[model samples]
Target: MHIAAQAYGRTSKTGLPTRELEATLLSQSAARLAAARDRRADDFALVVEALEENRKLWSLLVRASSAPESELPDALKQNVAKLGAFIFQKTIDLIENAEPEGFTALAEINRNIAAGLRGIPADA
Candidate 1:
């Protein structure tokens, strides 16, 4: 079964979907659980920061996408590209400092964000 469908599916016995349960696991209440499972606080921070950076990059992408391609100044595009590169490098540096668990967390968050952005039209 698809992950989303499985996640939201109700158990045959209890007739309760796992969505709410899974939400709690990934929610703020799961901080301890995340820490226990990962066994490192630095990894958790990397995950959180990567998620945040993804959001910031998303905003930039949306703004640039809305602007007319012809009207978008070369300098503006260059600056955005440069900023993205800088952020990417910073993310790499952060991952390097983190342990394996932390690096995995960062990579997962970054991949999810990238996948989400890929679904949206670049020109939109």
Candidate 2:
């Protein structure tokens, strides 16, 4: 998928308070993945399936968060937060399991993701 190309345009069309929050989380995840790519773009490209799964999760978060009004709420916001955290943690676990020696990539990705998430506007 055109994940790298598409992620840069991420934003919320839905006025739902959680939409921007979701976009923020997804953008941060994408940035983390990008950091991994920077460290070993060729290596990650070899694990296309893992990368594809990451893209799928990101896409799901975007769509779910951006859904129209009347279908959104604070509970969904909490779920979004939970989901983002879960994804990041799971990614780290995967890295640890599959390439323990490559922990730097995992650590860097998590750090970048956290930083990006922190940058999101709270007024959403």
Candidate 3:
């Protein structure tokens, strides 16, 4: 199933609000990336798979935020687009160079965004 559709289905089944579902997905992506980063030395393929998943999640976000029917604010949509571009570039860079440190920014961004969606401070 498509990631967005799966998320929607999960929300409907669990009675979670859209924002909460989004936050949960983001957190899951972040955790996957972080775990892959930590285990990169043991298994490089994990990193690649995690990066692909993160990219897919970001792609969905970018498309949704950019859609004309989206309720996201213009500034937020622009920010998501910019972040998506960076994430795509970073994913390519990591795939090419295989730097564990590079995963930090990607995971951090997801975590911060998830926290925002949950109405919590990133640090907290």
* TM-score for predicted model 2 compared with the true structure: 0.34
lDDT of 3 by residue, 3-79 (tens): 65688667767889888888888899899899988998888889889998889888988988899999988999999
Best model per TM-score: 3
lDDT assessment of candidate 3: 0.88
Local error of candidate 2 at 42, Å? 13
Model 2 steric clash pairs: none
When 1 and 2 are scored with TM-score, the better candidate is 2
Error of 3 at 82 (Å): 0.2
**After superposition, which runs of candidate 3 have C-alpha atoms over 4 Å from their true positions?**
2-5
Q: What TM-score goes with each of the models?
A: 0.33, 0.34, 0.91
Ranking by TM-score: 3, 2, 1
- The segments of candidate 1 whose C-alpha lies over 4 angstroms from its true place after superposition are 1-70, 98-124
Candidate 3: Cα lDDT at 81? 99
lDDT of 1 by residue, 5-32 (tens): 3433444555654333333223422243
Q: Which 10 consecutive residues of model 3 have the lowest summed lDDT?
A: 1-10
